[model samples]
Target: MQIYKVGGAVRDRLLERPISEVDWVVVGASAEELLAQGFRPVGADFPVFLHPKTGEEYALARTERKSGRGYGGFTFHASPEVTLEEDLLRRDLTINAMAEDAGGRLIDPCQGQRDLQEKWLRHVSPAFAEDPLRVLRVARFAARYAPLGFRIAPETLALMRQLAESGELQALTAERSWKEISRALMEPRPDVFIRTLHDCGALRELLPEVDALFGVPQPAAHHPEIDTGEHVLAVLRQCAEHAQPLAVRWACLLHDLGKGMTPAEEWPRHIAHERKGLKPIRAVNTRCKAPRDCQELALLVGEYHSHGHRALELRPSTLLELLQCFDVYRRPQRFEEFIAACEMDARGRLGLEQRDYPQAGYLRGAAAAVRAVTVQPLLERGLEGAALGEALKRERLRALETYKAEALGEPSDPPETPRP
Candidate 1:
């Protein structure tokens, strides 16, 4: 049997990018033969084996035919007769269809190298439309490589648009779609992913909540970009530029969903959109089975991002209420992520990218200021039960008031003591 490294490892190596993992394809070998050689059989639907020593995956070269629909609707054939060219031809993208031999000889039966040099994301065959998930995969690949100047071939883009209009995207499982989305959001140019999907008509099918924002207008005074969709992309770009975590990036993505629902007569004004966004944000979270932290933070940002921007001007009581809502004393990390998302939103506007976001620092300091007030001191003062809770609240409120004064550059005014 001849083993050759295939797919991403070869593609990334050729692009001079760091290779994270290597996949091997064993040609001219049967599953029984590999098992006899101590390769562990691990694939359930197809013939995939684990190396006896390194444990890297080694699958027999195979080809597939569309047997049904969606991502799971496929029939596979793997045998000693399947040629490496046949296997590579079935891949989704040309750049991912190349393989390498043990002697360092390159295999490019699909002209993957030529496509890579041309910075094109071209499909290997027309059969690419057979698998609906390729729409998402192509968008993700665009996100990953767009920073390197890669663009989807017009012909391939037409194929993608056809698949998107085929009504097959709705058949994809929520978990699988979220997997592609989360990965794309973490890429260096994730905005390209959204724009690519929208350009090919897949965004409307898969994420209508986001697509609706495309033509919606925003107040130019605050958002010079005017279009809410453009603002969302800008936020995603800022998140990536800052290297923010997945939770923050996703939050920024969903932060303005409510703006899409605003009345046309209310053009350029979306008052209360923050609270109005909670439903769509929750819908997205529940559909994707997003992690609790991500869901909670997205909801928090959607409901309070405007509040975050107006932080310095809020009443001391309102500021305290905001901190209490986030439970900043208990989950400081979540509050920090909330601040990061808000910062991305504030900086995402046109001509505001490099502008200061003092709200982030102000809110962070507010959280820290309250966190510095402990219940231990109250407990030491012979306080207990409801009285102890009351004392802690008062102390924290007092601390926030002082912080507000400092942030506003005003004289410190001590809060009145609560009667016990």
Candidate 2:
């Protein structure tokens, strides 16, 4: 009997990350053998156990059958005869198809190490298309390794599109779908999440709202670029590359979604695009089963007209309005994130270098203004209590007024209290 480390744990080991989860494939263990060994038994479809000491999961090496429909409909065979190589061969990707014996001998019959060294993601077997979940998993892997310049196997991508068009992808369970998507969305290039899905045709099947963005026209001046999808990709690239929180980055990626299906009638110099853009996103979010929180975040992005540029003549009420949105954004550094995303969207506009006026000056001025209003001074003067906060607010207002004409917002007023 052999117990081998498998799957993500091996991948994490190679990536030099701490292993949080461990799966031991007990090659010759039956349910009775596992139970005798003090591993807590669990599984109808696959034989699995919890290690008695470490409490880590330990699943038996097994074969499977597509007994039903969708991703979950699998019948497993956990016999003593099934080989470890056979089990590994049936997996989705080469990077995930290696096994490690207890003595730490890694068995990579699939050349996974070569693929990992080349930074390429490839399916383990041609049977990869048997399960629909592999489509989403590949998209996720693209996001995982995009920063490292990895590319999927062209043939693998073609097979994915073939399966997606076959309509098998719809069989994926919501739980698994959400898990893969949330992980991908949290990746360094979530655009890869969307792009790979789109290129392979699963995007329309899973999330038509984003797919509808393809080829949608935008206002000529604001976007000299081709379509809404292209612009969104540019901005999302910036969002993914930035240090903003996941939710804020997601907001930026989805911000302009409203404009895709909505009609635009421009009046010479103004279009009220933000307001016009909101309705479609709201409708699409509600209709497409988008979570309420994601919908609200999307609105937060599309509703803001200011681009974190020029403080030109922003008044107290304008600043207050921005802060109100910040307050509802549900994070400690929401304003910073929002401002970062807004600047990304604005500076990413087509022909940024061809601006009518200097864009950098405008961006710096806008950031200062947004920051001044949303992030009040940490303290006030004259004793403690709520009075300190009042003083800080008063000082911030004064600073804002005094520095209104400056290229940037006012410098932060010092804390009113600091004894030596």
Clashes of each: 0, 3
lDDT of 2 by residue, 28-80 (tens): 76888888889887665458889999998888788777777678767777788
Candidate 2 residue 345 Cα shift, in angstroms, is 1.8
Cα lDDT tens digits for candidate 1, 1-420 = 899999999999999999999999999999989989999988667799999999999999999999988999999999999999999999999999999999999999989999999999999999999988999999999999998999999999999999999999988999899999999999999999999999999999988999999999987777889999999999999999999999999899999999988999998888888878889999989988888888999999999887888787778789888999999877889889988998899888888788777778888999999899988878889999999988988998899888877676763752211100
**TM-score, candidate number 1:** 0.96
lDDT of each: 0.90, 0.70
Best-matching candidate per lDDT: 1
TM-scores for all predictions? 0.96, 0.76
Model 2 gets an lDDT of 0.70
Would you give me the overall lDDT of model 1? 0.90
Worst 10 residues of 2 by lDDT: 411-420
